[model samples]
Target chain A: MQQRTILSTIEGHAAADPARVFCRFQTGAGTEAIGYADLLRRAEGFAGAFAAAGIGRQDTVIVILQHRPELLYGFFGAMRLGAVPAFMPFPSPKQDHALFWSSHRKLLALTGIRFILTYRAIAAGIDEHFTGLDVRVLYVEDILEGLAAGTVPPAPPAPAIAPEDVAFLQHSSGTTGLKKGVMLSHAAVLRQIDRYAGVLGFGPGDVVVSWLPLYHDMGLISCLMMTAVTGAELVCMDAFEWVRRPTMLLDAIEQHRGTFAYLPNFAFLHIARAARPGQRWDLGSLRALVNCSEPCKPQSFDAFLAAFGDCGIGRGTLQVCYAMAENVFAVSQTTPGQPVASLDLDVEALESEARIVPAAPGRDSRQVLSCGRPLPGAEVRILDGAGGDAAPDLAGQIAIRTDCLFTGYNHLPELTAEKLVDGWYRTGDLGFLHAGELYVLGRQDDLMIVYGRNYYAHNIEEVVTACDGIAPGRVVAFAVESRQMGTREAVVLLEPDGTREAAELRRAVKARVFDVLGLTLQHVEVVPRNSLVKSTAGKISRDQNRRRYMEERAGNG
Target chain B: MADEESFREVAQAIGETLMVDPATITRATTADDVNGWDSVTHSMLVMEIERRLGIQLPMDKVFDLADVGELVDLVAAARSAG
Candidate 1:
């Protein structure tokens, strides 16, 4: 095989099979099939628009468009000029526009982004917050409306790109909160796609139906990059629309004979709940629906199976993948057409001692689903608190050394050094190796995964502390598992600065958190000034406060 | 359905989903006025309203509701359309 960059590989595919459909984009209007050649040509038009604005190989462009054809074209167009492109979420209708755009000032400053490709309305929104920031905003309408069919302005000469050069940056956060740009090189991304696609038996005939946002790794790497690399077909819908109409995924799968999909555990529950009774689809065409991103819950899979078993879901249909953006995508994935393994462990031993012990019959046990074996070039290590290897089946911080490991965090060299030690990247996730497979526990840090998005405890605490009637440094934020919802819900506890109505205080905290962070706090309680627990270091301990909160709730019940 | 009847039904659904007092839910009540009425709960509340009113509201119009009054009007409109 000839060595190729991502752009060359896609361009090669387009040259070889110009008429092959690459993507079927679905929206409120209708589905539009874009062939390989048409997709690339449109991308080149975007490249021309970028080049006319003096954007080239060295500049970084941030794409802030919604889930539309232009989002895809603008992303690839920037890459077409050998420039690094990053996808960012647009402001949701629920979010305040000024707050949303202001939140990205740090990101814009840190990434040195010189160009932002967005729509006119969003460009107007960004202009208010980003004045004097040395950034240029390019509107899609202005760029595309000027170019008629067969009259695209010629792009400048393509820059020669090496495989090891930074291809793009994938940010973990969406519109608000913490943002870390995990930079992946072209070689690393292509290598990851090759291995991951091989494990899933993916081919050009396979059709991926997804509603995942392109900013996330699961969508960017797995759905978009894989299809672009393997010349497979993709059926995609707007993620926001899918959230409101969860059944659209099923409809697309059945209509397109879709072979695969990747979803977080919460989506399985969301779709199942939205489906009315006796409503079903012919889902026999699907080869797998891999649960990923968040901690894969056995109960979520069970709920999905119970809901759709008669509609062609089988025991081997639901799979699991333990993945992160640092590895480009999948670290471990369950085999296709095989039932995922499960273990019943002693809940007390696992939670209290951090040891994996098989449960005795008729005892309290936690059912854990295996995120099968690692991809060919990836190695998993369990590290104890002492930074040494932990014994097998014992919980520790999960570390991985992989051929496709990320280059580093984009511009934070210190953060890169702190996370990637030697040749191994220490994932702040806690998990264990059992029977040659990975069983992921929850996060070891103060990070919480809600609906597969990461938010730090201190971030939420900071928002609450800034609100009225809340004491500074007196708010503690944590997550509680909701089995019914198949996800984690954030809970906030705070001590008030004065005597305020409890309802008013709670309402204020929730509203402020939503306004500032674009997330809802499930529970907000105002406690006494000194009621929160502290660690030995005199810092507020999220773990202890979470345990105390759970105990009090149990007692109340 | 009468406008008053629709308001009461919508308030009941929102109250049940958010665990708030139904009496306190007024036409002016927005998501910011009640705790736990975030986007996710908003979808669940819409479904509950659909179940109660026996009318399927369009998904596009269901989002971006300004207040409980808007939601009640949406439900009443859906009932007539169906």
Candidate 2:
């Protein structure tokens, strides 16, 4: 196979299908569709405008727009000029302004972003914070207006972007409150896109419907990059739209006959709950629903299938895949029409002994669904505490070496060196391979040690969320060191909808945690929904939550 | 019934759903008046009201329902038409 650069592939697709719809955006005005020819013209215009703005090869530019077609234009425009584009998470007022500003400053410092392209709305919201910064800001609409006026200078000759050249940077979810930017090379990105397209059987005829935030890896690389490379029509929506009216996603998918879509586990749960009676949409066109960015819950898959079975969605259409920004996106994807493989293991034994013991069907066991075998050109290994390869059933840290491995953290050699050990990237995810299939337990950092037993926080959260009155997929469980026990104790933070009594809810949470994980929780804090902090990448910030808890405890003391 | 009666019903529902005092909801009252009328809570309000009244409100109208009076009128129209 002749490997081509992302830009070359996109140009080829544009040449082949200049009249085919490439991207669609919906706004208050109405829906707008841009064909491949229009997409290329806009991208070129963006490139020209960026060049006019003094951006050149190796320069970093930050894009801070919501899910709009202009975001894609800005992203590809930067890449077309060989400038590295970093997608920064949109600022949220709910976050601590000081911390958010500091984090943004740190990211800007790390990337050395000299220019930012954003929508006027977002720019206005955060303009105060950018004051005095050396970076220049350009509104996307203004840039488009300049392009339309033909006032923007023509782009310089396309620089020869090598396969190894840094293409873009994606930040980790900062679940531990420390954000690390993953620098993906053009080759790494293209390799993953090829793997993704092949695994999902996507082609130019396919259309991808995505509501995931463009800043996230799953959204930026999988949905945007894959579509750009394959010339697949993409229907993009903001995360707010997806959350507010999940049915709208179904409607758009049906209206566009979208063949491919991607979502996190929470989205499936939300859609399942929100799918009302008498609401129907023809979703038979959807061939694949790539579930990633979070742990794939079998229950969510079951619920989604049951809720929209009439929409032509079936069990085989739900895919469990796993990847990280470091891998440039997908590492493993389930094959179509394959029975969803879920491993029923004894949770007690798995936690206590670090051994995965299979249980018979119909038995009460913790079933961890397989995310499938690694894609071609990717190698995965489970290493024990001593860094030696673990046996098939022994739980250990996941490490991978792939052609799609990112080019280390941007400008952070110390962090890069720590994450990239030997020849493999330490994923910081705890899992074990059984019969060549990978089952990701949880993040190694998120493991809660209680009474000398290891408990995955995600599993605990899943169990807690199953309890009545608790908000599904909104709980955070972590281990805090107990002063009396002189050991880490399980502390579950339940973000309820505020309709339940605190005392009774706490009791129920404690009992549920105890019953599910066999570990007694030391404390349960029922915080408000959205109060439990999460990083831009949508991972729970356990360290930040723990620090906040400690601060609150100190204030009370 | 007049708009005021419809307003009371919607205001009471919003108060119950959001766990705020119904008296606090008024024509000029915004989500800021309630303890937890954030975006997620706002969606919950829309979803609950839609479920109760069996009406599908437009996305903009849902976000535009800033006060109890507007919410009542929207719900009343949605109900009366059905």
Best prediction by DockQ: 1
Q: Report how closely model 2 matches the true complex, as a DockQ value.
A: 0.15
**Interface RMSD, candidates in the order listed:** 2.3, 11.0
TM-score for chain A as predicted in candidate 1: 0.96
Model 2 alpha-carbon drift over 4 Å, by segment = A1-3, A92-103, A120-133, A175-178, A360-364, A447-557, B1-45, B64-82
Give, for candidate 1 chain A, the lowest lDDT window spanning 10 residues.
A172-181
In order, candidate lDDTs are 0.87, 0.75
> How close is chain A of candidate 2 to the true chain A, as a TM-score?
0.79
Clash pairs, model 2 backbone: none
Model 1: how far residue A244 lies from native, Å:
1.0
- Put down candidate 1 lDDT per residue, A303-343, tens digits, no spaces: 88889998887879999999999999999999889999999
Top-scoring candidate (lDDT)? 1
- What level of docking quality does candidate 2 show? incorrect
Instruction: Give residue B68's error in model 1 in angstroms.
Output: 2.8
